[model samples]
Target: MLFAIRFTDHQSEYNVRKHYLNYHLDWLKQKRGVVLAAGSLREKHNDQPVGALWVVKAEHEEEALSIFSDDPFWVHGLRASVEVLSWSLAFEDMLKD
Candidate 1:
């Protein structure tokens, strides 16, 4: 199944996010196959990273949640809120195939 995980950063946690960025990226590399697409969400105007979005493939919701739970950012409390939802692509694409 496909899951979309949206994470909102904690207020004033940019420093923490930057500090653990390498570790978080390394962790994402370890789950390359499962992680379909991932990137940081940027704030308006200033272009600062305010959160993250990840589209992943997993057998179940719990498995997807586990992935987020283990992320260095999430583990270190960089996220203020998170939402994981099952997703279906409305339009077909080579990547989704």
Candidate 2:
């Protein structure tokens, strides 16, 4: 199944994010197979990232969410919360199997 995961950043953790960005990117690279799509969420006025979103392929909700436990952002307290939901793709042809 595919899962849509949203990660909200800790408002006060800008320094933490900056400090651990490299580790975060590395983690993302390692999960490329599982994470079908991923990117940052930015504020409307400024381009600063406020959160992140990912469309992931996993067998279960827990499996999709569990991948984040090793993320630098999550481990370093940069993430405030996480939300996960099953995703049903509208344009199935847009993604390859």
Candidate 3:
């Protein structure tokens, strides 16, 4: 199943995210699931990253949660809130195959 993981940064702990960035990206690359898309939610004016969004294809929600638990950022308390939702993509036109 596909899932969208929406993460919210802690208001006062945003600066803590830098500590685990490398570990987070590395885990993403080594994971088996497909990361269809990923990015941070930006502010309206300054375009600062206040949160994150990830689209993942995994066997189940439990598997997806496992992947998330391993992220260093999650461990360091940089992620204040997280929500995972089942998702579907309606188009394949943009796909290479």
Q: Which candidate is the best by TM-score?
A: 2
Candidate 3 lDDT by residue in tens digits, 11-72: 78866767677877887777644776777787785765688999887899987777678677
State the lDDT of candidate 1 residue by residue for 1-97, as single tens digits: 8999999998688888889999999999988999989998987856888898999999999999888778899889899998999998886573553
lDDT for position 58 in model 1: 93
- Which regions of candidate 2 deviate over 4 angstroms? none
RMSD of each: 1.7, 1.3, 2.2
Taken over the whole model, the C-alpha lDDT of each candidate is 0.88, 0.90, 0.78
TM-score of every candidate relative to the true structure = 0.88, 0.93, 0.81
Candidate 2 lDDT at 3 equals 93
User: Model 1: how far is 37 from its true place, Å?
Assistant: 0.6
Give the TM-score (vs. native) of candidate 3.
0.81
Q: Between candidates 1 and 2, name the one with more favorable lDDT.
A: 2
User: In candidate 2, what residue range of length 10 has the lowest lDDT sum?
Assistant: 40-49
